[model samples]
Target: MKTLSKKDIKQLNERIGREVFSKKDLLQEECGRYYRNKELVFFTLPQGRLAPSLKFLLKDLYLPKVTVDMGAVKFVVGGADIMRPGVTACDEGVMQGDLVVVVDETHGKPLAVGEALMGSEELLAATSGKVVKNLHYVGDDLWNA
Candidate 1:
């Protein structure tokens, strides 16, 4: 397992407003993805510790490097929500129906894995489409959840 930095962990704790021991310690898995019971889990996963006004968790795993400035944690560990305004960056190679990794710009981490409603650039530049609504946790199969 990739060990997270203590400094980064501290920031995450501050942003989340909760004490964090480790990244793995904060998650629970179901099928193949991991998830947190709380919303905006990214708040507790950033190096800034400051709560991100906007963010997203898109992907099968977390980046633990990508951080954002403002935005809500759109996607959680499990398939949850993915608002348009919260989207920061997307895989340019993704398609409207392809599975893609959504990320929280604030902390630069994958928030959730979901079907793409729009492509990467479109998701970033355009102002329409689902852009990624169907989200599933890295391990929790929302299909079953």
Candidate 2:
């Protein structure tokens, strides 16, 4: 693991729209690092995108989220793309091409991170077919890495 320089941390904070790491936190930090903060949260992505690890979702950070019914939990955590039927709710203002966090309705815990295939309005109006392309999920290589 490579430690992040001050500039990197600053950029990351900007991308995530909040202060993620304090100077103290940065002392032990590194780029492309994933750690368990209750679950697993990636400190950084290869492209420098900051995303909440599924475990981190439990804290309810203010990222765009799509909630799926209990019936979809197994498939979502297993890395299946989010289909329209499974979605129970969508955070308002989600747009196509945006990154979204996928969660289970029962616990509101994240199961995966995905790219929206449709806007929130469109997703809510549809009854079938894919809505979000799953990018990272529990038990995927990134999760294990």
Candidate 3:
């Protein structure tokens, strides 16, 4: 478990809008007293946190090592309009602007990586609009990274 330094605690107080917890309080709040030596900590995004919140959690919260992968999900891919057709299926519980691993329809492998343009349910329901907003090239996507 990585303990916060004095500077880190001060910054957390400024960002979280509360006094930073002492080491013992942080141990309770962050680890529930289950201390481990692992450096890579896995955390679920807090409920109702949109893109801005994620950005803050990463940039300000010292979550330097994180896997933003949304795992498997369903959403429309490659369409002129986002709110219309082409949505074969999507995974579950994804939100807009989330970093996701877009899979290929044929082989079920990663086709590309990008931020979601709409919620999973919204993408499934709508027939047209931008769906998965492309971010980087993968498996020979036409766009440049």
Candidate 4:
């Protein structure tokens, strides 16, 4: 692990559009290049964009949310893409390509982080199809890392 310089932390804050933990708390893992603070971990996605791990997102709770029914919990935790039928609610401002948290409706606990396949309005209006593409979840490599 390596401590991140102030410059690196500043750029990360810019990329995520907000200030995060202080430099003293931020470390970059050597193996996966994942960024870690005292509280959470995040990493670059396959699309080459930075994204928070599901655990990090739970602590931060800043992403727009896609709420799913209890029935969908199993599939969601298993890394299945979110299907329209299982979605119970969505934050209004979500847009296509936006990062969103997938939460269980019952407890409002985040289950995964995904990229929106459709806007919130469209996702709620649709009947049956894959909507959000699951990118990170509880048992995924990122979570383990």
Candidate 5:
């Protein structure tokens, strides 16, 4: 892994819509071309956007959230897209195409990070069909890396 330069870090911050990395040791890993600090990893999605790793989600969960029922926890952790039926709650202000965290209702622990397929109102109103596209989850390759 190589340390990121200030220019690279600035671009990354813009892509992820956050300015969390300033002086932290930012290392670029080859396993997934993920950017990492001492405690968190950030990965690039298929669309070329940066996303938070599950570990990062746990540490700084400022993203909008969607709570899933216990029955959905297994699928979520396995990287299944969050379905409408399984969602028990959705934070207001969630918009379509926004990054969101999927958490289990029992303990409210993040199970996966996903992209919202619909807005908060649409997610809460829908009865069936996928609502959030799972991006990263526990036991995924990125997680293992």
Candidate 6:
């Protein structure tokens, strides 16, 4: 585990286009640390990039999200890729290659973070096949980490 310095936090905030942690949050609470292991991988969220763990922690805040039907929840939490047929809704402005949080329709809780394989319009129009490449999901090593 490695704690992020104030400079690192500032750089991360700039890269993500939002302040993820205040100095107090990091210094006082010791919350800005990166954990890495064979099962869990940690890295900075690159400029304009999003990670599943970050999305999960900030779900209450505004973020682009994709909703999958309940039937897909099991597969998603198991780290299976998202399929267009299972997607029930998507936030507007989600373009191809965008980072997206995957949530179940029942409770609207994030289940995974993924890269959009298609734009929102294309995702909604498709009737079948994969739509998002699952990067992280509930019950995965990152979640446990």
Question: Top model by TM-score, which number?
Answer: 4
CA shift of 29, model 4, Å: 3.7
TM-score per candidate, chains pooled: 0.42, 0.80, 0.39, 0.92, 0.90, 0.80
TM-score of 5: 0.90
lDDT of 2: 0.77
Per-candidate Cα RMSD to the true structure, in Å, reads 12.3, 2.9, 11.9, 1.7, 1.8, 4.7
Backbone clash tally for model 5? 0
Tell me the deviation in Å of residue 117 in model 2.
0.9
**In candidate 4, what are the lDDT values of residues 90-126, reduced to their tens digit?**
9999999999999999899989999999999899999
Candidate 5: Cα lDDT at 42: 85
Give me the runs in candidate 2 sitting further than 4 Å from their true place: 27-40, 43-48
Please give the CA lDDT of all the candidate structures.
0.46, 0.77, 0.40, 0.85, 0.85, 0.72
Error of model 1, residue 142, in angstroms = 6.6
lDDT of 1 by residue, 1-145 (tens): 2233556566555644556446455443222223354323332222322222123333224322221124545345435556666565565466665545555665555555555676665767766435565344444523233
Regions more than 4 Å wrong, model 6: 27-61
Report lDDT (Cα) of residue 41, candidate 6. 25
Error of 1 at 70 (Å): 5.1
Model 2: per-residue Cα lDDT over 58-114, one tens digit each = 565566999999999899988899999999999999999888999889877778988
Query: Candidate 1, which ten residues in sequence have the lowest lDDT sum?
Result: 44-53
Between prediction 3 and prediction 4, the one with superior lDDT is: 4
